[model samples]
Target: ALVYVVAGAGVLAGSGWWPTAALVAAAGGLALKAIWFDPWLSVGVLLDVGVIVAVACTWPASVY
Candidate 1:
């Protein structure tokens, strides 16, 4: 759901993806509002960003 998409965006962004990441994040929000019945919470965009930053900094550069 939203968490997944946000995480995916952050991961992708950390891997050098930009607009796609934004799209993913937006999509996550949209999915949360549209698909899921629980629309009271905002997607954890910051959490995903933090995850991306951490992974990017800790991991070595490699194409996988």
Candidate 2:
């Protein structure tokens, strides 16, 4: 939740290490969800994947 929010903020501001942070957070969230929360698959998984994709795609090249 916190990671999602921070990533969102990072995407919006395009500052700091938000994009990378978002990617890491989204991956971690997906793993944790799969391992514990929604092991059977759910909308949460889809959302996590979406966040990861969006962050990766929109990540500024300058940041790298």
Candidate 3:
């Protein structure tokens, strides 16, 4: 939830370390989810991975 907020702020601000923060947070959240919540095969888990990937791929172009 907090990761999503940071990611949203990063996208909106378009500068600073927010993008990297979002990327790291999202990845960490995904890892935590995998470890404690569900198997890697679950759709929710895969969605979390997708969010991490999306943040990573977009970070370079997004941050100023």
The backbone clash count of each candidate, in order, is 0, 0, 0
* For every candidate, C-alpha RMSD to the true structure in Å: 7.3, 3.6, 3.2
lDDT by residue for model 3 over 1-64, one digit each (tens)? 6867876787787656675776677678777776787554477667767767766577456354
lDDT to native, each model:
0.52, 0.75, 0.69
After superposing candidate 1 on the true structure, give the runs of residues whose Cα lies further than 4 Å from its correct spot: 1-16, 36-64
lDDT of 1 by residue, 3-62 (tens): 556546666655555434545555565555566645344445444455456455644345
What is candidate 1's TM-score against the reference?
Answer: 0.31
Error (Å) of candidate 3 at residue 49 is: 1.4
**Candidate 3 clashes between residue pairs 3 or more apart in a chain or in different chains:** none
Q: What is the lDDT of residue 22 in candidate 2?
A: 78
Q: Which pairs clash in the backbone of model 2?
A: none
Worst 10 residues of 1 by lDDT: 55-64
Candidate order by decreasing TM-score: 2, 3, 1
Q: Could you arrange the candidates by lDDT from highest to lowest? A: 2, 3, 1
